[model samples]
Target chain A: MDHLSILENKSIFIIREAYYRFRNIAMLWSVGKDSTTLLWLVRKAFFGKVPFPVIHIDTTYKFPEMYAFRDEYAKKWGLNLIVGSNEGQVAAGMGPKKGSKLDCCNELKTNALKQIIEKNGFKALLLGIRRDEHGIRAKERVFSPRDDNFKWDYENQPAELWDQYKSTAEEDNHFRVHPILHMTELDIWKYIKRENIPITELYLSKEGKRYRSIGCLPCCSPVESAASSIDEIIHELETTHTSERAGRAQDKEDAYTMQKLRSLGYM
Target chain B: MQDQKTKCMVIGLDGVSQTLLSDYIEKGYLPGFKNILDSGFRLHQMDASIPDVSSTSWTSFMTGVNPGEHGIFGFMDLRPGTYKMFFPSSKDVKAPAIWEIIGQTSGGKGSTLHDKYREGIRRPLKSVVLNIPQTYPALPLNGVLTAGFVCPDLKNGTYPESAYNYLKSIGYLSDVDAQKAVEDRDAFFDELFLALDRRAEAFEHFMDNSEWDLFVSVITETDRLHHFFFDAARDEKNPVNKTFISFYKKMDEVIGRLYARFMEITGGQGLFITMSDHGFTVLEKEVYVNSWLREEGLLKINAVRDYYEGIEFGTKAFAMDPSRFYVNAEGRYPAGSVKGSDKKAVVADLKDRLLSLEYDGRHVIKAVYGNAEIYNGPAAASGPDLVCVANDGFDLKGTLKKEGVFGKGNFSGMHTRHDAHCILPASIEPGGRLHIEALAGFMLDKLLIQKPQRR
Candidate 1:
């Protein structure tokens, strides 16, 4: 098999294994290229149907285009979409302008996801985090576990050699199942082109600027690129030395902030 | 200005240390190295990878990355989540090698090296890589390659398929019979000399016949010789001392011949690099780290077994060959006992205990490094939690079947990380500490940056 097929098969196997093992499971969808590709993979895995609910922790700070795309894909893919938000934090006016990006992310994203997982009692939450995204994320396991407090103990992670994943978690803890952890940004684009996966139009070049990575509108910025199509994006990624997350504001705060953020359960 | 052909030649003498080479050169035994030294090549001491094994060190050298980036921590690694062991081959290397970096097309984009050459049109460089360790079952490249030690089959070891026939017809011996040294010393020397002759012959053939911008060949018989006959090589009164010297003299002649050919090919303008993967020293004691861990109650084996399957769930930490330590933490191992919260304390306690270890009133371990201190990359998480570096004269082994903490093995020499040697052309000046990993980048810069000057 080719490299993409191998990656797809591994991801599909992990998704299937998580489904079989977890009592209650859900997948996180961010309406970004990576997570959208993952959403496509989930449908392909279960034969044009998602077996579990797909959750999106909405900070309400995302681009309107992102919300539109998410809503459209949710109906088109026939997904049991669960939109989660920390209404109390939003009501309190917690945002990037109010405090540090770290605190903002924790309040809107981490806490919102915590509430969803707590309310749903999900034993596993499939994520589309790739190792090549960030340094701290690079250290993540295919089956990572979070504590009852939703803390990621990255320092002492479970050993995941070859295909063996840590399927079991302690009581009150949940596994952050990363199906596409091994795929790189380039691989995702290549797979998206090969599978003809539809992505948000915001990713394409608009006046020589395109979102290489999409998050809340206040935090993520667009890079200078002329990549209006999947092929152009692939070509751009092939030659670009800039990181996929280089345009994100939170990661630029400090070197250790991402590690600290991930440890506190911010994906 | 656009016509000068830039070429680079790297001669790897496995296990030849800086101190030993200097001493031999002073004694006029290795005239070939002396000639290079006379020809304005500066000898710099280089640091090998942690644990000082050939597989990790050579991989580090070739890929220009640490074990963390390359994902080859040692020769043998545990099949993660299990006690089963498997050898990490070239296929397991996570980073692009020097050759791969120079050989890649613009279409192959994901490899880390391609990012550097993105601005310009890349012309793939042809290389002749022969007998470099850890490169077994040769992968397809824009060059001819024959893998070095641990290469089980000749047909599988050679690339391009046609080179295999040429090698076979030339009676190329991949490696010498190390076992013969234990059975009969005289026959072992004969085998060693024959292997060296065959290797030199093959190197000469490639130097003359192959069209390569980068040529690399390693003489690995030196490492085998040092492992078995290091004492003889060092001592004048030993029985095989003369034979050992003769072997080096013969190797020196081959080096001279290769150097002359390199000069002819490049008109003395090309970059010529000579290096060893790691140095060697006479073994004072073979320290079994696992046995010490067992004695200290940190490790528990169910019974005497050949493999790590004998380890029980209660084991806090275990080791693989040559001082790679891993914590048997919960969720990592099938029945790991150490919890995530206690992993730091366990590793700390183990490090302290290892640092304080003494053998015959001498400290066995020189330094102990945490994973974060030495390694920084994607693959760091999969490496050893704590890598123990041994002091001189103490050879650290991770063998589980060993009966005691310290004993003498068949080997007279053990690998040392710091004394590895590199001889570089005087024109290039390295800024700081010379590491085995940096050589690949140096070679890449010299070869790729010297693109034909446009008039």
Candidate 2:
């Protein structure tokens, strides 16, 4: 078959395998291109039925546009949406301005996910991480195991040959299943165009600036571009050597910041 | 004369093993190989990638990286989070190929090479890559590319749109029909010869027409011949043995012609390398791994379906195609019963049992590798927990539909990991382990720049 079919088929297969294997599973939706595309694939895998809950770890620091996109799509897609937040931390006014970006991400994003996962006892979580987004993610596996403390052992990981993934983890531990780990920024855009997958307008240019990679409002920065449409974005990716995560503030804090964050269970 | 531009040519004979090629060369059945050997070519026994299939092996070859780095494990991979199977294409490959590296270094836009070219320090490098497997839906580069196997059609497979009509005009065939081979042997033989001739024609056409510094072409028909007629090729007494021998003889002639053209092009100064993705062996029995898992009470199935969707929840351990095993741990699967503390014991027990398995008074499994022992890299985490390499003649399969551990199928040959062949020039002495993954870097060192060490 062609390139896109191969990618779509493999992703669908992984989505199905995760559903069949995990009992208390949930997919993470950031209301971004990658995660939304992942949601679309999930629906397609189950024949327009999302068999499990979709958790959005709300840091209360997202753009208004992002919240609107999430609410609209969740209702339109008939999703069992669970909005998770570290209310204790948010009540204390913890944010990027109060501390280092790394610490803020840990308090707002990672702690929120940890609370949600613990409350729901989710054994596995489907994340929409791609290898090309960041160097640290390039070392990630399709089925990455996390310890009971929610720490990732980047070293001493399991061997994954063929399609046989490591689904076994220690007690109180869980798996972070990344179905889109093999995809690139270009692949996501091409797929979005091909499937006509709906995405937020923030990705398109407004006055010659667009958010190439979307996240919390304080962390994300827009790049100069004329890509108002999906086709133009695809073309931009083809000609540009700039990384997809170049606009993220946390990534620029240090070279090993991403690795450290991931090891600490940051998504 | 010694300062002429450096060039390289790679002739890939798919599934041509060093042992079998040596035997045939010793018997004077392949004069072209013998000529290459006499003319300063050193033959090395190379190892194929784990789960030694064309998709993984060839990707490893082109990318100069293991399956873990390249992100293509086999011909068929289970989609993440699902049991459904899908074929991985060129789009799934994570590592950049040697040609792409060459293209990037040869004065592509926004590259260091472009800076060098602006100062008139160097010229752009061109390449001609033909019929390399896993290159379907060929991407653009500095030169021409015609994808190998798994190419659905020529329209999408050939780059530069013009290459398509030219190839069509020359009647180039991407692959010989395997179904036709099964239905009629005579017509199949004719098709094989015709396909080889067309491949040679295309290779020669690009060699003369395209201004290229690197040229690569593979003869996949060798793999097809070995699969169906391995017994006949090995046995002189078989009625079709002569036909098999004749096919090799024709391949030898084609090789000789290509070598001559390469010599003329480079004036005998450029490098010409020959290799194969993996080796071939006679299939004595098809051993079903999942059947054994079921028989040992480690696996359970609800139905007799061909895929993993039939796998029952209570299953503790299961397998996928060609001897890949997974543990159904408590937190890993919905109905998994094996706890974290019991996982080590389960894996040990499974390995011991698999090694002890015997058929016809002979041991079936050669070795069993843990994930840590064989693979390394980011994608390695999703790899098979246990990979079993079977002894010669015992073709291990992971199909769940089999009723028993032992069975036979239509094919007569299976893939061998250790006996794959590579013929490099005597001047280039390779060090350390020899694998298909290292060949791309080796070629890169000869033709252009060195590939950076893997992190």
Candidate 3:
């Protein structure tokens, strides 16, 4: 099979596997390329419908367009959208600008996600993480488990051989499912183009600057690019020396910034 | 005192596919490896996950679940119906790993790799790990781990002073230029294999210093080397060079070194597991998915303006990526160009056109759907408005041109679904099946000063 179909088939298989294994499952949607594609895969897995709640951790500092689009589509798509927010933290004036990059992220985004998972008692969470996004992310497993305290045991994980994934985790059931970890940035864009997956306009270059990654507006920056079209983005990736996460501020805070955040149950 | 034996050393090579390894081994190019395989397990074919990349596959090895159950899709996800990126590591997953379970059952988070053996301070069974790809942020365990190649930037070229100099003296990093530094085929391989030898030496140093459970180390040079050299191996015009052969021989020596060290330390009683992540493949052609959308009329671009004028220009005027397209209405698109009837017709027409167009050389589009039809779950709305898949090898290419030659253009080789990159896992004991993901924690857990009962 060609790359895309093979990718699709494998993702579908993964999604199906998650559905069969998890008793209390939820999918996280950041409204980005990967998760959105994953959402589509979920539908395909269940034959035209998703069975679990879609969780969106509202940091409140997100771009206005994101909220508008989210609300409209949630209603239109009949999505069981669960908007998780740390209203306590947001009301206390917590944001990227308020504190250290690490602390702010912990409170607004990471902690918010952790809180939601706990509140809902979800045993498994489906994520749209890829190995190519960053160095640390590359170490992630397809079905990675986290502790109740949300500590990721990077040192000790399971052994995934063939398709026999260890989805059943009794001790720390905070497991993650990654379907498109193998795909590169280009493949994602290609998949998005072929599938017509909806992505943030922020990713598109506005006057030669586009956000390679999207987080709170204050934290995410745009990369220099002429890639206004999906085709252009692909071309740019082929020749570009800059990494995709180059524009992400959190990654630059410290050498192991991402790793530290992740170890504490960040994502 | 009771007799104590040495534990085996297993190196988990994530993203290392056998598909590429067998090709090299079959060519009789990796002679040193032949000797190493003399004592260890060598699978002619090792399977990986669909995407065959790290995130999903590694997790599969760690948790032993399918991608769906693990719920990791891509690096970033969109909030349902919107254009927001959801980072999986930050907000997507919710699973516990075996080590965490073991630690919990035994009490506490265990030890950090740095804390356990900092400054090369080796205790009994003190495992030392470095450059295993995909691991990061440094886990506190009973072993010393320098994370992996992707471990941001601790040091470049030279080894960390905190690390032992055994490998450096033997020439792991210093002996040969890394694959990234060497473009010449022969030189690259030689550098890599020499580096692997150095890697083995480092493992030996740690093994001899410590007298305990598990000792593991990964050589990323193998995966890194294959990525570029796979091309040389396939093309006769660019045949494998002498340096490349030398590197393979060096790898064999490294393997031999590892076995020898194990024998010296523990009388050859410990288990030795060696494995790789996803395999590799050569790119046959490049598929520009976007350009094909225009060819199929699934993507319509406005003639006047080239930009995607959000609400101003109508969605019908242009198509986005494989995700979705926008329809221009009066206030939506930039110029208010497409009006009432035209807007409706454009949306309807585009939908019909996409559903009917022949993406494969012959068959018409079978199914065309927006986010609502395709995905469900919290993030479903954030997904693409429309999802389409062409036949195998006929994946959507984003080029604007209608059609052209297959093997001509941008991408030389790539990874997609179907290519399940195999990973040989590390084992704690001898005569047991090993899973790749369990590698990190396995080394750490094995090195624990106090043995913890399995959960």
DockQ per model, Cα: 0.01, 0.01, 0.02
Ten residues in a row with the worst lDDT in model 3 chain A? A258-267
Which sections of candidate 1 miss by over 4 Å? A1-267, B1-4, B105-114, B117-121, B304-306, B450-455
Better of 1 and 3 by lDDT: 1
* lDDT for model 3: 0.56
Strongest candidate by lDDT:
1
Instruction: Give me the iRMSD of candidate 3, please.
Output: 15.0
lDDT (10s digit) by residue, model 1, range B1-455: 22124688999999999988888999999999899999989898889999688888998888888888888887678787876666676788888777887777222323343355433325778889999998977888888999986676778889978889999998999887776777688888889999999999889998888778889999998988998878987799999899989998999999998998888877888889999999989888988888899999999986433367667768999998688899999988876999999999999999999999999899999999999999978888989999988998998887776788999867788889999999998877888878898788668766776532333
A170-201: candidate 1 lDDT, tens digit per residue: 89888999999999999999999999999899
- TM-score quality measure for candidate 1: 0.62
Model 2 docking category: incorrect
In candidate 3, what are the lDDT values of residues A37-147, reduced to their tens digit? 788778778886779999998888787767876787677667899998888988999876764455677777778998888788888988988888876686888898888
The sequence of per-residue lDDT tens digits that candidate 2 reaches over residues B410-430 is 677888988899998888777
Q: How well does candidate 1 reproduce the true complex, by DockQ? A: 0.01
CA lDDT scores, all candidates in order: 0.84, 0.81, 0.56
* C-alpha lDDT (0 to 100) for residue B125 of candidate 2: 64
Report the lDDT of model 2 for residue B187.
Answer: 90
